[model samples]
Target: MSSMSAPSLNFLAGGGEMGEIIRATDWSGSPLGTPETWPGSLRTLVQVMLMSGQPMFIAWGPERIMLYNDGYAPMCANRHPWALGKPFAEVWADIIDAVGPIMDAAYAGIPTYMDDIEFLMTRHGKQVETHFSFGYTPVHDHEDRVAGMFCTALEITSEVAEAKARKADAERLREMFEQAPSAIAVLRGRDYVFEVANSAYQRLVAKSDFLGRPAADVIPDLLEQGFSDLLDRVYETGEPFIGAGVPITVTDTETGTTIDYMMDFVYQPMRDADGEIDAIFVEVADATERHKAEKMQAILNEELAHRIKNQMAVVQAIVSQTLRNAADVRSARQLINGRLVALSSAHDLLVRGKGERASVRKLIETAMEPYGRGDGRQINLTGTEIEVGPKAALSLALILHELATNAVKYGALSVPEGHLDIAWGTSVDEESTTFDLTWTESGGPSVDEPSAPGFGTRLLRGGITGVESRVELDYSPGGFTFVLSTPLADIVIS
Candidate 1:
């Protein structure tokens, strides 16, 4: 057991720092024994592994003793100088669970190759994600026995991480495009192939088969509407184009009906790294409803101006008639004030309504507010829901005010036990619908018919003539009653 004398290690010479460490290390008590008595195959493999510029390693014999080249030193991390003479399994104890099976496969001569394999390895006291592109080749010894596994490895962690980051970025961008509220689309090349169209863009076009299809093929209407020309200008000049409230019409594929749209949009040319425009990005907001509202506001402003003039005329007529018919100056002033208040109440009712028509219930309630004590005994009125046109509404309010004033001066409302009851109903026939409102008063002094056609008498008859309505008055010994009948269509303005 004296064995062969120590020998010159030419196979381990001039191999940089790793080779010196392996050469100087005492392997006398290990499973590998001294290097002088190493197998010829293991010696030759070690020599080849040492001379490599790439990272390479050899685990030899049944113990799988570790030996690696200078190129593999950085991969060893803090374990380099100490990892020189240990078994492969002990040296890579951190990743042995993952690399253990691959080693067995290579040692069994099946061989293993991988472009990328992942391992969470603790290196330099921190766990890091590691990737390797490596190959394991079976090393043979004397008499054709498998001696060990040789490995050539390179780390590719950064490359994998970068690729994953780019993929995640693309997915995030795709989600943003899909969920955008406004219409968004991307067109590529001169023929304008649709590469991306979001849900809003699909609805705006009234179509969904847009991906990879030419814009003209899908929507020739847009081409005829000169959108293609705009796109051409943008693409050719490499400049952005903006359209505000641009009218567009699209035909529905299912119904064959044309839908009109007003859109505020942009055709932004997308340029490449060479500064050449390759595609155009389209973003659009539908402004049809907004445009319609603006137009409606303009019309309302005009109507408001016209109504203001008409209201002044009506007020002037009321003032002139009140001053002419009053018996005294003080009486004329009171009459004018009362008539004006009634007119104001009518205007308030219409304003709370549609401004063109007023509700019958609101008109009566407002007219009677000054006289009613809120006890439900003075004024009892019940009626079907009806809308009166603005012109008729003003006259009706004044008529109600006059009737109440006359009652307070001479009729039922002059006494504590007096009460007024008015009821209205709709009578629908084949020809037309007529509105009938009946007013009756009781529990007061008797009333006599007027001797002449006074201002109040003329007002009651002619004030609501605009609606083709007729008013009737009855003077009975018990109480006075009044009734009004008019065509529903005449009083209700659409």
Candidate 2:
């Protein structure tokens, strides 16, 4: 028979729209007779049928006879079939007490459910936590009034345990992302809103609070730099985009200064379950400092090339002159070799300093080494310790070497009584410092200004000018004078 065609009990238990409770014994009629015909044999056969292959339990009213199918009975906490047909409260009082609220709701004509409730019960002498979702439904009488309650539930223990485990794994993944050593951020939607950011991202954009803000809003400069548009396209097309050497200008929040940065990153689109693009993930690696160092290195290389060419031309000119004035080929070869040796010594000093900045004192000492220390009484050196960087030192050393050579031939140092004075001092002006050095000669042959410029005179002036400096040569009656000034800031000490 269908469930609706089944006969109901005579007693009204609790549940219905209108509240009423009456016992079958008080009514003075057969328990299953009168208007409600509940046949015991038919009810037993029906209960057995409903219990087949299902977790179902039945509680009859008044007598409160409890019954369960074989499938449902095994899940009970230590109870037996012999205990069936007894009052539910009498046989399994503890289980019934714990489930009383659910039963009460069901008897009140309201279906009740408990989702993932933990039940700690002893099984094989060991207590284990079992999770289950239980539901209780009301059984009605002949008058369609609430009578007893039925329970149908299954153990969801394994599913609950797995869910908890997965939740913990997800938490660990989140921690890894948050504690990463480099910047990390998550963007969402086509607009690429900043859904989340790590500590490193906060450090870069100090003033902007990135969380919950759109990427473009926090970094307006990114829009102009094409990053915003690039992300939008990547999201729209569900494609990954990569960039390198992207120049960006960022404001230093503390110093309020503009700083340049070079960055490289990839925009990878994230998809939803349906495989439609929903967001973009940006992975950025900053290389600003490295790029700047590389550029500076390139500039230094160019300067070194220019200086080498200039030095070679000077040496060639000196060799040509010596050859012209030589009385014999041996004399010409000897003079060229001596001058080349002096030039090589000066270059050795420059190289030892690693091209950073050369020491002015070292530069002069190396260039003058070829000239016998000249009687100390003949050449007077009076100067504060002023440094010249590599570029400046190289230029100044060449000029000093040419002057020393000319002196050995025709100036003050050419004779025993001839005297030379060299002095240097530094002064600062605005953003630049000027290093002034004076070279003066006296007590030599009364020298007159040459009618034509010589290689020594031209090189002294040209070399200094090539290195962004100035030189003034005077043909003084007393002997000769040379004044040179170069910027002090370019002088590298280390």
Candidate 3:
């Protein structure tokens, strides 16, 4: 068999590995035949691709045989050398699904351009992500018919990766800005134009369309509050200013009403690339609720101090009266100490009820708790739920203390077997509402009425003050009994 000699092609005349490989490759086994037998158009296209510095390639004939310049070798990675003289589909089988349609369009004489096309190529024995901007154009033969597809590509993997990283960073920053708790705004330019405002800032100003607008124009009220001046100073001097408890008035867009609020804010200068002050960054924290709470606490403290002084004066009077009425120092001291304890017990109940009204049953139980074990063996209490004003609770507490003291000294609580039943109830008529209480003692030593009433008896009878108040004492041989009746109107109802 005779074979045609290789042609003295200009493209193969270059001193490069690609040119050497082309000139040395055997053409008898190839479907396209020898270089001398190749058409003028294909030869001309190969010469133009070899001399060019850009990355270019040609896939010729129905088999789409691969022919590329030195510039395109790096893009082939480990697949170079072996990739030459092979079909385009075999050289790029990894991305044939993506490049097949583009090649088909080009072969049909329709050029295809793609920007930043991504491919997952298995190069260097590992899959790598790559990107490229490429154009596929039709190559015509001497007969002016589509013969092959020509491709020119530039790798853009690094650029595309950098762009993705930048986009992710921007998205994270936006999330942080939107979710910030404190009001934050970023202004740009010497005019203090609003560039970025978080949700908090939008809520603070009661508006959202502030971007690209001057801060002073968006919030004119800030001009009077000196906030606009602060921004100007920060921008001029490139220094930050912080203010605490600054008052500002804002209008409610929904109600068209003006509201005054206190804010702790800062105006910080933002610098440009040249280190020149360009704008101000504003951060604000609402302190109106905190200020109101502080004011209320101060007033409550003052009121509490005044009440304490009044209570001390009342204690002093009680001490003096008890000392004057006692027969001796020891007696006076014991009486005063017991009375103060009783007073403290009433105050505790009042405190538990927030110093307003106290339950009548709670007052009795608390006053008698120290004298008896709560098992109902020595002292028992029975009553309906009724709330009494502070004054009434105190008076009733003292009266109950006096009655319990008398029982301990000579009545029910004096003996081991002795017991007392303390009960109370309410009665309402058309004319008035009345409270009735009874203290009955049993299983104790014999009782007798005293010719001269002691301080305990006198206090119990006279301590309670109301319009229709009365007390009845019975000194029966079995035990001692006391009954109290009073108008319920004297005590505040709960």
Candidate 4:
């Protein structure tokens, strides 16, 4: 690289370090012979490019010979001085796919401008992603033919990456809000215009006309309930408000019905970068179902307490009756124990917590259990399935206990040849549905009405105890028959 020192190169004198480098460069072996014979337009453009502080380059003649100023030297990394005399396309062969068309267009007398273009280039043995905003202008020759291109450019890789990061962050935030289970909403500005409302919030309000409208206008129920005032206070003070188990009543706009909600909610003020409140974030957790369940539990507790008191009264009556009717102390204990076991069987079904009801068939079987009687050989029971409430079930259990006791002592059950048959079925009349049960004793000694009624006889007559119930007794030479009729509604609990 020898100094030219020619007086004709004064145009190269004022371009700083690039001008000194160009002046000292040799041209004997170059395709373009010398500076003295080179095209004047190319020389003048090179002079202007060198003097400019901006990153600039020139690709002149058919070969696109490359020339660049000091400002563009660092952009080329280690390829600076060597890239000088090489073709621009060869110097940047790795990025030629992206820049080839622009270069062609500039040489065809057209200019191309781009605010941002990206390139992945091999820089100093490492792959680097870079962005640039540049313009390529056609440089005309002496005959006014497009023969070269001039470019001005600057790197903007960091700026583009920052903007992309912000977009990804915004998308993630939106997804988080939408997928959350709790109802979420955003109100912006002093008017409290709805900026966002997620799916849960839509279901809570049962409305969709919330966006771009003020809260007071779209959700009148909240406004009427003084919640609007509360929101305003929070926004003005930039403070957060939280409420737990707060009750709110709203009208169903479509159905015109009122619904109540119990909610645990929050109103959080959101601030901008400058610490000024710009919006309010709302979150609501519905608690209405929990409240209803608690209320039902309270009602059930009261029902159980009431049933306990009634059961105590029934036990006292059974105790007194057994003691009065017993012939001796041992018989009294046996009678009381049998009656209580029957009573316990009915109670076991009723107190199972499914509901206060017992199966009619199960109660009958239980009562006969104490007398060592079952339906297989000497006893037969046939009935349509029926369910009875606590009141009817208790009475039936006591009545059956008395009947079985009598049979075991002096009736059909007292003899091996005797047998008992109990059958029940339903009837429908104009007024209601009813049921009838018949207990018959057969194949025993001849029977007739007793001289006077005893506790057992009285219990049988009065035990099928609805006001509409009727009982009949028949004492025949062959058997004793007892029948009871009652309204079906008096027994069914569910």
Candidate 5:
């Protein structure tokens, strides 16, 4: 080995990768010369950066050549060893736009401290978002003039990511709460001050301002209903309370009128980490409509029971009278079966109407369906649009059914070429409106008047109780004709 002076080891006294690198570095080609010949201020700053546990750096001279401790290498990523001797602008060109102003201020002798400053930097050959908290202070030379800037920085990327994640979670929870179908609210503290009220809750209260107000203040009537006391008990015991179909009368803030409502609701205590009750969560559902439906259902059930009993008695009377008048067992069975079937068909029409008014045309079609063949060429129906209430619909259905059955057995429908024409019209007057309907049979065997009234005959002649109707039957050489006159007020929907 040729004689060459050993490189100085004095810089290694600072003790780290950065200090070791400085000791072995060649500064002969640089403007600042060797590390041994550098000013005391620059050396002192390098020593401080090397010995400290924090990430620190120094940009020196007019060129702002960069120097950094080992702690800063990870932040530099792939630029580490190469960044050691490079100028500050070249080393951090990716974030120069954001860092340039801070550098300028430091150079102007103004110390700056920034927290969670965001920047985009290229690390490991890929651009990434990063956040940092740092302080930059001016470094002095031997003449007590600004020569460089010293900085201590902490990469807060993980902390900021966690904070952003928490914020996103909170926003999602708020959105779900607002859009929930049931009314919901949050009350904080023993006083039950409202913290959050969703849109459903707002609508339930007619959009009153309830936030930050105690429940009693918002709806004083609830206190009288013991709702406030229920919340207190739930909170005190850390238990939940649930109620259904509970009646509460509240005054509408907008209308200034008291309204009665039924509610299904719960008051649930929310506990903190230490298992202490902190607040109450309220969930409510409006049950007023359901309550009304249940009540109406009970009343309807009672009425239906009474109606069924009366119907059974009427059927019993019909069977007994029909059997007594029939000539033999076969005739009696036939008459009973026919009448029962007619009643069943009428009952079906009433059921289809849901106990409301039924279309007159629909009733006729349904009642005569069994007697008519495909396409119904044997019968013709002509009438204006008319609706009849349940009682009239059932009675008319029964009358039509009996007429259709008799036609099939002994009248026009008994022959292939025979035809029945059904027509109805309305006559309106000052005192009342009357409906007139005629059933005419033609192209059948010559007819003869019945010697005695049968069950069907009586049923057609206003025999159905509660039905105010008059009927006339004609037996002529051509065929049979039936005429019906009924008050429109008893059947018309209006």
Candidate 6:
């Protein structure tokens, strides 16, 4: 270790006057009257020395050290005045551990300096940690030999206590991070190497035994799946990356089957002391069961949509036929009962599918099967993943049945060579979802607009009323066209 430099030591009062004061006064001498006997210039010097901010002490005989001014005595103001003339140790034995080293250095003529030293000192029956900046310098005799030492110190107890409390709080945060519940990994750089992995992270990768490996090497599948790019982007730009509905393939050893997991994750950047991003904390949650449930719900929705349309078609046919074929009031009532029985069968299918929507393709095929071949090619269906709600499916079923019934009676399906082209597309128009479906007839007998709107038109228009949509039925000489417009949100895919 290197030696420390010597600090400056200029006494408040010079040697001659300080020596005189020491000789004129007893072992417990103070500056109260000694200044009156001295020269005016010396008296002025002693006054200034006594008034200095640093504590001052003088030794007049063996074992007696007197404190000369307000600076030194206030440090012990609570002590009895009769204790002042006694040896320094007798009055200050409570803090002798702190005073012994300073006194030894000064009396041996070796000056000492120490700053912010902490020690417990007894005051009013309580031990308080007293911080101090201290220096001890020996007084020289005429021949320059060591006589006694003087000590100077300042208290700084509060600062050290605050620093200690702050350190403890930081340590607690570190422990919490180490034991977090979620799968968390702190990564750094382009490779997103794991600088720290919590206990949950270890269990996730199934390698709790080797925690310090690079994240890329440990989880190669994650990098291959493009998760590394997200991690690097967050680390570089200091932005967070959040993702949901991400799938993970997990192999179960017991079942010998591949299990699919839906997961959500977040990658948040951690900045270092210089405000540069140095790490990223990755959090992942498994949502496999939730994803499976959503898929099942989509299938159920499609089924319900199919059943509701069929049920509405049966009701429309029953009401329209009963009104047309009744010979008298009693006969009409009997006919209504028989038609309602057919409607009841359709209602049974609707109840079986619960409240969710059903597949439009299946519903359309089912409605048209009675009129012509069930093969869907006869009715061109072109669209991407067109989903419909329960009410929309029921309404669409009625509309398709009405069109199919007309085609069998007087439109396309009545002829063996006739074909119905069904095409659908989605678009955003006027801040609403518009599903434009074009249904055209070809190779069929000539057709013209109905002389008057029939029960079919009324049922078609009323079926889609609950949902926001418009149905247009146009009849031309060659064939008929039905254009339907509806909100896209009403047909949202599950």
Model number with the top TM-score: 5
User: lDDT tens digits, residues 1-494, model 4?
Assistant: 42447756656766677677777778766766577777888888887888899989888888888888888887787787788878888999999998998999999999999999999987898889988889999999879998788999877788899888999898888888889888999999888899999888888887886799998787899778979888989998988999988999877788988878999899999999999999999999898987888897896676456446545645665566567667999998988798778767655654452447777888788766544447468899999889888778867776776676566555787677889998888989899888788899998878879899855677688856554678998998898898988888876752
Name the runs in model 2 displaced over 4 angstroms.
1-112, 119-129, 136-150, 205-210, 213-220, 250-259, 303-380, 384-494
lDDT of 3 by residue, 1-494 (tens): 12223345554567367877777888778877878778888888788888777888889999999898888888999988888878999999999998888898998999999998999999888998999998999999878999998888888889999999999999888788889888999889877789899999999988888799987688887776787778778887888999999999987666778888899998888788998888788889999999999998996686466446545654665566567668999998887787778667755765565367778888888766544344787788888998888777767876776676577667777667898999999889999888899999999999999999854566677746443578899999999999998888776542
RMSD of each: 10.9, 10.7, 12.2, 11.1, 10.5, 16.5
Q: Please give the lDDT score at residue 194 for candidate 5.
A: 90
Best by lDDT: 1
Query: Which 10 successive residues of model 2 have the least lDDT summed?
Result: 15-24
440-474, model 6: which lDDT tens digit per residue?
A: 99879998887786556666655464666677877
lDDT of 2: 0.67
Q: For candidate 4, what's the RMSD?
A: 11.1
Candidate 4: stretches off by over 4 Å: 2-55, 69-84, 94-97, 119-130, 141-147, 250-258, 297-360, 363-383, 386-494
Residue 186, candidate 5: alpha-carbon lDDT: 95
- lDDT against the true structure, per candidate, is 0.82, 0.67, 0.80, 0.80, 0.80, 0.63
Residue pairs clashing, model 1: none
Expressed as tens digits, the lDDT of each residue in 1-494 for candidate 5 is: 11124344343466477777766678777766777667888877887888888998889988888888988878888998888878898899999998988998898899999998999889888889999999999988878889999999999999999999999998889888989988899999988899999999987776567799987788677777888789889988888999999998877777888878899999999998998999999999999999999998996686566456545654675576576678999998887787678667766775665487888888887766544232648789989888887777777776776787677667887667888999987888888888888999999878888889755676678723375777888999899999998888777653
In Å, residue 349's CA in model 3 sits off its true spot by 4.1
- Give the C-alpha miss distance for residue 345 in model 6, angstroms: 18
Lowest summed lDDT over 10 consecutive residues: which window, candidate 6?
1-10
Model 1 bad stretches (over 4 Å):
1-20, 33-53, 69-82, 123-128, 142-145, 307-361, 364-425, 430-494
- Tens-digit lDDT track of model 1 for 152-265: 998888899998999999999988989998899999999889999999999999999779999888889988999989999999998899999999999988899999999999
* Backbone clash pairs in model 1 (N, Cα, C under 3 Å; residues 3+ apart or in different chains), count: 0
By TM-score rank, best first, the candidates go 5, 1, 3, 4, 2, 6
User: Which should have the higher lDDT, number 5 or number 6?
Assistant: 5
Checking candidate 5 for backbone clashes, the offending pairs are none
